[model samples]
Target chain A: MAAMTHTETDGKQGLLPAIPAGLRAAAPVTILLVLGFLAPLLTVAAYAFATPRSFDVFRSFTLANFSAIFDPSNTVWMSFAWSLAYASATVVLLAAIAYPIAYGLNRMFGKWSGLVGVLFVFPLFVSENVRLYGWVLFFIKNGVLDGGLKWLGFSGGPEVLYTPGIILFGMIYVYLPFMLFPMSLGIAMIPRDLVDAARDLGASRFMIWREVELPLAMPGILIGMLLTFVLGAGAIAEAKILGGQSVIPIAQDIEVAFTYAQNWPLGSALALLLVAIVSGLALYVLSKLDLDRILGKR
Target chain B: MMKISRRNMMQMMGAAAFAGPLASATRAFAAREKELNILCWEGYNSAEVLDPFRSSQGARVKAESLTNDPTMINRLRAGETRIWDLINVNNPWARKVMAPAGLIKPLPRAEFEPYFDTMLPEFKAPYRWAMSDDGKDLLGMAQRFGPYSFVVNTDKISKATAEEQGWDLFNDASLAGKYGVQESDDWNVFNIFLVAGINPFKEHTEEEFKAFAETAEKIFKGAKMVGDMASLNQALVSGEIDLYMTGGTYSVSPARADGYPNLRAITPLKGPIDGKGGISWIEITSTVNNPELSPLAIEFLKYVQDPEVSHTVAFAEGTFNPVSQMGDPKCFELFTKEELEAIQWDTLEEDMARSAEYDILPDYDKALELMTAAKRLRG
Candidate 1:
């Protein structure tokens, strides 16, 4: 009878404290983030400190990999510089190219906007390498452009494939949609009455765009720029398939270290450095933006 | 409706419970005895090569192809030895790497030695790469070899000039921006050493290293493009490039077979390594050191030695190559005129004579770093 009374008292107190509903709801995504994102990142971090050229991650720790990268004799820094330069150029070029198309989608497409949007996204379903190779077939000597031109009594197509310029061109072509959609959403977010109000208040076309439209659409534009820059910085295929390795991006260097060199520590260090740069830039931009407002939260 | 007794229903359930595991165990035992798994380079995994063997042996055969030899070797190192029954890679790995690592088991000498006698003369009995370094064990079987050097359009740079000029052709200032470089790191390093008049196989002094670096930088900077075999071949066909470095009959055979006979892989008449200017890669297929070693492994090895299978392997996957079995008259007769021309059969012997066997370089890592640095500096 005493033992039964003790069990009753414990039951009344509850075996465990109740979990908050919000925490319960977030359990799945939180677990996913920990397992998928955090675990791999931690593994990479552990590898970065491993002995150079060795797979002794966690068992051994040394700064040798970082030292090798920091060594003055290493020209891997040039690859990093090239990758960053290309990424920056890609962002600027895509901004220029996607803006007009994005504007037309918002202001002109009407109810057909979704269909036009699908056309832009259609190429994404095809493999990136296949589409790039199609470009290769089109641009290559005696290829479609050259053959067609020659048949029409023209000299031939200009030599454009397999150059640094073409690498940039390929990146812009590939990342255009990443820039375009976000920018379209940003432009669409602007209230039409505000621009009209600015115009009625005796503002010039440029002034209205500057004071009302640009600031309002800045969030989407910022997201687009961030997306393109991050993706461009990690670009590898464009340099290989299109540029003909005219330039070795940092990603290729990291790949070589992992594969041909069999230096997992060095590869991890290189990857970590790239991640730091891209993540630092991303976090800085993301911190400044009102994500709640951008995402349509009340 | 008639009602069944509970006891009868209980008996049926008890019998099913007892027999289910027995059936599964029997199936598993049968599957284990008949299963053969292969890890190899691309050609050996093709349906043309595997399907007939599967049907003949009544076995369940599976294969995975990887492009890089080191990557496949590393997979074995990472505990995949238990999963694979057979492994086929370039020749040196068997003698130089895999044998030392114990990733593969030696074949029976009496059974496998006769196959070598039927192979090309270069792969005659006691072939160095197909044996242990101590010459006590038969390591593997050799097939699919060619002299890899550089290729050119015979129309622009005649084959004679290419052979005569050799590595010096790349040094000529006029050829800058005219030739493409295949992005094969190992072959590129070999070619760069040849260009620098250095033997890549030997350990190099600091001065030789400096020379290698300079040659690498110059080669990368001078080339019109650096790309894969398909891209380089396309560029060659399109007239965008006159020649490409690190090519062979293996890389150019498809184009040649497509009626572009002017495109030819050139083996230089002279080189730094004992006067051989070209590197040839021979593949060796060996039994993996799996705990459950399949009996079918040796049977399939012998099966591929047959003339029709050899011909099928040579032409598998759209890339044409000459197999060592072609040295046998029976295998030679299997080739059609077009196929013979495709593999550049006319020059195979002479090219092989002029080429050094591909081997592991003592300073490969250093050379790769220098090569990678040169590539980056070019960027």
Candidate 2:
């Protein structure tokens, strides 16, 4: 009788909460998620079938908007290619730069690593657009970079601003912090004893890093790559401020579609295509990674 | 009565107290008739033009700046006609697009037609292009207008050379990456047409389009930076670019006011299209379809025709240009000699003659697509 009573009490505690309690706990987040995300997505999908003549989705429906995407000469394809290229470049470049810095900071700085980490994140405090504008001053012809070069005895230098290379540099510069923080957190999470054990076993520094640190920091690498890729892929201001006419990516094309073309259906379709692409890629990535481990469920 | 709690009773009392004033405020807002909401280009939103009328009539004027006509027309088509009281668009859009679309109301002849007598001689009569196809309704009243072409740093490239070279200047490989292009697709499309020796104002043959594409592709390749007026001007002043393609007095004269007096606009003397070298844009101010705002719109029409207000419109902040109202002696007197020189007013008449008015392109969409493709190709 005592065992039965204890089992029943555990079931009551674990399986169910009071109706009001359950609602109160979930209501705010549920409401926020519905309003913030689902509504906009449904609206975008509805608009994808809407024609420009009427804002009401029910008034008109056409597949022309989707068909327009297949235009052989459409600049959107070029823009999409640029988006992928830029995002991939930024992700790989940032991973290379961020990994070393993160490892060094955690290993070398010891207890002072927090302050050093804060210094790395200092640029994030300033607005992204402001920082991009600052880069403009440095990158433009006869700008700070060129002036510095001239002062260093070069008469003139090649144009740096509004080039493909400068845009790549800007992507790395702006998103480096996002990559660094996650990687450092991952590095710090690796127990100190593991490193000491590797050292006692006479493992080379490079060998220890390759075998021990790299595997341990996989979660951080995944997180860093995901954040950096998504942020850089959807970048508009950096492209506008630094890329100029030299770089016209899909974000700019979507902007032009809405603002200049006044074709909401077309713009919506284009936007949906972009969302599909990014989501597909993200899902593929998540499939490869052990997200449960990253979330601490494992 | 309903056995309200203390909190509920306080809320009810508060609501009762606020409802009276709120109702009165709503009534007062609807009753205020002396209001005008205008959508116009950059130069027309100046307080110097709007303040006098606002103070004189005890009215409020809300003005918004627009970069192009299609954007404003698109807004109206999207049900913004009820919000905007008056609109200013280029002549072709007012006639061919807005009027036909019923986005704008026909102007009352007695109220608006007389202003043309005081305007430039070209506007003195009912120009067919400014009227509906059947020629019955007058669509809009004309005001601020000028020949829009290219601007160059006169110290770097002399006006004589710029005028003489015409569209050929852009074709020169020596000037490659030395000029900046603004990303006004319509304007650039027309410019490419001019460069390709075809008149964009008329129907274009496929061969002509091919030529235009070639020219546009080449022009895009030659440009170092493509941006708006601000960026182009910065590049010009910073010695990054010597020429600003598709610029006009509207872009250069403002910089003159800011001490960059070396910047000057040039309208070429001849081009492939019947020897016409540049395009003149005339802005037409029209009342929206809102019947309630018609009276206020009429008052504004008369107000803008006043020479002082016209002068303010010409020298509106961010840009300065010669207004058609300058034909009036009163308006002409407001411009200083230096200001006239800054706007290249001495050569204005000659430039005007050399230029043809901008017209509606039958295949504007196709042109936009071509230009866009060319831009991408350049990228």
Candidate 3:
């Protein structure tokens, strides 16, 4: 039986053909995962336990770096909570805004969809920093928004720049397209015949969408949520530039440790903690949704 | 006959595609014997100053700007001393920290004393703070010194009014949301102490700490925006905010050079201690402890003291500041009347007299914690 199994696996192939096709196809990505992702993570983990003052990992190990995270004086807990909330809000907001736009673009623009798709991605051509600053020009007091409002005879407008709302708006603006494209692709892949069949069965358009289209788009929504959440959680620029010091996220605290405080070990510890939290959350959600079969389809 | 597999063939094609640029990049990193690596502030490495030195000495100059003294000192302590040939930092760090750490070596007094002869009388004598504590070694050469204080838009508020109000201007409840704060945590602590009527140069009592924290919270709350030096300048120019806290010639000069002379930095007339309301920073150029590069470092110091080089360093790319070599006739000639006025040179002497030298605050860790907590409360 063993001989038969081996023969079947190796039949009509070269020397390495006994290796499964799936493993062979995944070899490049596995190499990248080890070298690019795992190596840096191990380095950061090693540094997190280094002697704080000297920054020498081999000389000694200490927990002072990790202990600093709980020090109320640092207010790291507050910053962490702020970052989680900021990222959660951004993901929810982007998903809500992108779905309709993506759906309309995919379904309504049948012939011109290609051109309109380019327009959707046009903002990506400009860098994130430039795009954030563009928002700054529009949102700053007495800026373009205020000028236009005055021209429209509005008076005594509220200041928008340096507010928390503007920061979230900036994050949503930057991440909306990331959510849109994948959702659009997922929707387009839904068979036209399935929706037509639902309509022919005396189901209304709303029922067709609610029962069939939304379920089919789950993979794209999940992918979009993960991407937007990670990027938004790690973002430092939107808060620093648009929201000012009023919005001090965990990234800013990590930056202060490395730059101002000159404490690399503490920064590493905080960064690793943040990574653990984000990755754990993502894994939990993926497990619940069985993303393997869904996102794996693409 | 031998044949290459498809994977091997593609690998070879990829290698061939990247070979040229990879080879050139490797060649580009070849070490130069005469190359000088400088870690200093923005103005020290401007093209106008570095190009001349590079041309004259036939050397390559690689420079990196430092954000703060502690970070740079920590980098050197972590074994970067071998890589950097020169260090330019505020005098206190050079005298108290770097020299003591043996991260930098003493300068040759004979070679540098001549340049000191041409400097302002205050800098003519090797200041005690610019030397090793034992006073046997000249630890650094002074240049690019200025009174660093908050700046205001002269169009909205008169310089006289700002100077008279001094630190009190920021504490006013009526001024809430009328001004901005520069996002420098350490500097903000010093400013808070100044506003709270406590001298930061000494260790603070519990009461003083509480007062400083309260003052910081109030000031932060009053600010409409807290931004970096660049954004603070923009806010002032664009009328987003009328003034910014913790600004100086370093923040306003670039705007002035760009034709916005209305921005003005104010040195207050009175304070809690000795009636001095602002801090003055004197940047010192010192040689890193690299024996091989010490000669080039000293030569660069001499080159930098030249009038043209001094002017260039003073008005370097990001911001313009007044240099210590301003006493030199040639250096004085480099600044046009408008340029000097933009720097507020007319009141330069008075501003200097009214300012206290920038000193290392005692127990900075505690101050940093308290200030950070205060900032967190601003949310």
Q: Which consecutive 10 residues in model 1 chain A have the weakest lDDT in total?
A: A12-21
What tens digits encode model 1's per-residue C-alpha lDDT throughout A1-298?
6579789967855754486658867999999988998888988999999988766778998998899999998888999999999999999999999988898899988899889999999999999998898899999989999999999999999899888999999999899999999999999999899988898899998898889988898899999999999999999999999998999999999988877777888999999999999999999999999998788783
Q: Candidate 3 — which residues are off by over 4 angstroms?
A: A1-36, A51-54, A71-74, A151-153, A289-298, B1-32, B55-58, B291-295
Worst 10 residues of 3 chain B by lDDT: B25-34
Question: Which candidate tops lDDT?
Answer: 1
Kindly report the docking quality category of candidate 2.
acceptable
Model 1 chain B weakest lDDT span, ten residues long: B25-34
Clashing residue pairs found in predicted model 1: none
Report residue A124 deviation for candidate 1 (angstroms): 1.4
* lDDT tens per residue, model 1, B205-316: 9999999999999999998899888889899988889999999998999999999999998999998999889888898999998887888898989999998999999999
How much RMSD separates candidate 1 from the native structure? 4.3
What DockQ does each listed candidate score? 0.61, 0.40, 0.51
Docking class of 3: medium
| Per-model CA lDDT versus the true structure | 0.91, 0.81, 0.82
Error of 3 at B62 (Å): 2.0
- The residue-by-residue lDDT of candidate 3 on B212-248, one tens digit each, is 8888788877788888888788788778888888888
